[model samples]
Target: MIGQQAIRDWLFINGKIEKAVHILSSLHSPDDKVFVNRKEKDGSTSKVPCPLALKDYNSNMNFVDNFDRLKKDNQCDRKSHKWYMRLFFHFIDCCVVNSFIIYEELDTDGKKLTNKNFRREVYTGLLSRKLVDVQSPSILKKRTKSTTEISNHKPHVSKHLRLTESKHQPTQISSRRCAMCSTKKKPQRTK
Candidate 1:
């Protein structure tokens, strides 16, 4: 079993928790520390002292719960199916939550908006900023007619051609061909 001193030492290493505990202790008043009668499992009500940290912890948890709920309601990170996209989605969710909190904090006199509504408004505002007037769709239809017309196009030269062009026999073996390339056949379409 761990001793009380060990637990205290562990708490000391956690700077944020230590700072919060110190602040709570400073603000603590005798009247503020009220004991509420809690019913026990054995059928007895006992006056239990509620710590300041419990309230702070619960409030912080509530904020996180709200942030998660808002993220779930208005998800915008499904643009790609790749695994790496999850990181981007999480980042976007964090940004939305932070922006919503900042908006709420700034507007002291305005009616408080729910997390869902706040997220929707933020998304709509972003979409509004990106909206542009398109002159014509015909501009995007232009394409190079042939491979020769493309400036960046390079013709694929076979390994045999390279060996013939070079006077010295290649000391190194040509790189192993890809499995698909060795087949020398196009994939058949299902439909």
Candidate 2:
């Protein structure tokens, strides 16, 4: 599980790195070029232009190697605790939402923006969306009342009672009524 989590983390990091590089590339002017100039004492000069910085280009390989290491470790199958899985899902959702926000902020028309302001706008938009999945009012009221009742009791609610009262009730055989005849019946013996 640790290995899997590490792999996932690396993938997410790589995605962020890609986005960062894209943002940096887009920020550059169309005609910008890195030039190596050779000048003699007589002031005659020649310039060799490079499309991209060699050092900057080489650093991406390091990120690729990190990703490969994570993949080779093969740790994703490890059984994780429920809470860890929940947190992982939450992190993934946040990343996806943020990625969308980044794209939108970068692609918007005629707007001069800083990264901090862009992130703030995205977060505000996310907050304004009615995305939370709360239960209906009556269901919430019932849950609140039940929780309060449970809390008021000195000891915790009994395991059996809790199970019975859970949102997903356990399947139970209630008196085993015959489907054909309207009568409760025991298992019949085969002759």
Candidate 3:
């Protein structure tokens, strides 16, 4: 059985959890209120709270509950609980910065989820925000032919004649162009 410290170390080493405690602690607001303490010109400290409240630690709990639901439904890997926790923290960070949740933040693979309409709907609902764009990594095609060779599959044949069984055999002719003048020339016919 892996210890908590070992799991923590793995997560940290892999960059799966970026400052876990700091992120988790930031989400724990006393109340659903944005409190701002300011110093007045009269040298008196005044506290102003925003009526438009942020989601408290309860919201964090709900996120975890939803994650558990996903795990139960077999939609995500139950073994990677550490990854889920890190993802939750990232989601919280995105919410705090954007003042709204993002669907891709909760998605295991953003590209794969964005491709399916039904999954995208569920993702949006879970995140409580619309996604502007979810860009996937571009795939490149492999080059089969080399710039200097005619056929990539076959072995290169020499331009000169070959001696086989004490008899001179002419090499296969290649239709090539002149390097300097850019002129096409046929192979020389041997008698």
Candidate with top TM-score is 1
Clashes of each: 0, 3, 0
What RMSD does each model have against the real structure?
16.5, 19.5, 23.5
- For model 3, how does the per-residue alpha-carbon lDDT over 114-147 read when each residue is reduced to its tens digit? 2234443444456512122322324113444546
* Candidate 1 error regions (>4 Å): 1-8, 11-45, 49-56, 77-83, 108-117, 128-191
lDDT of each: 0.55, 0.44, 0.37
Which of 1 and 2 is ahead in TM-score? Answer: 1
* Order of quality (TM-score): 1, 2, 3
- lDDT of each residue in 81-174, candidate 1, tens digit only: 7878988888988898788778888987778888877876676566523122222335435643535445564433335644454323424336
* Of candidates 2 and 1, the better by lDDT: 1
What tens digits encode model 2's per-residue C-alpha lDDT throughout 69-175? 53333222335578888667556445544564456557867675544454445455655232223245586566533332234534333366455444444343575
Model 1 TM-score (2 dp): 0.39
Clashes of 2: 3
Q: After superposition, how far is residue 54 of candidate 1 from its true place, in Å?
A: 5.5
Residue ranges of candidate 2 with Cα displaced over 4 Å: 1-57, 61-108, 128-191
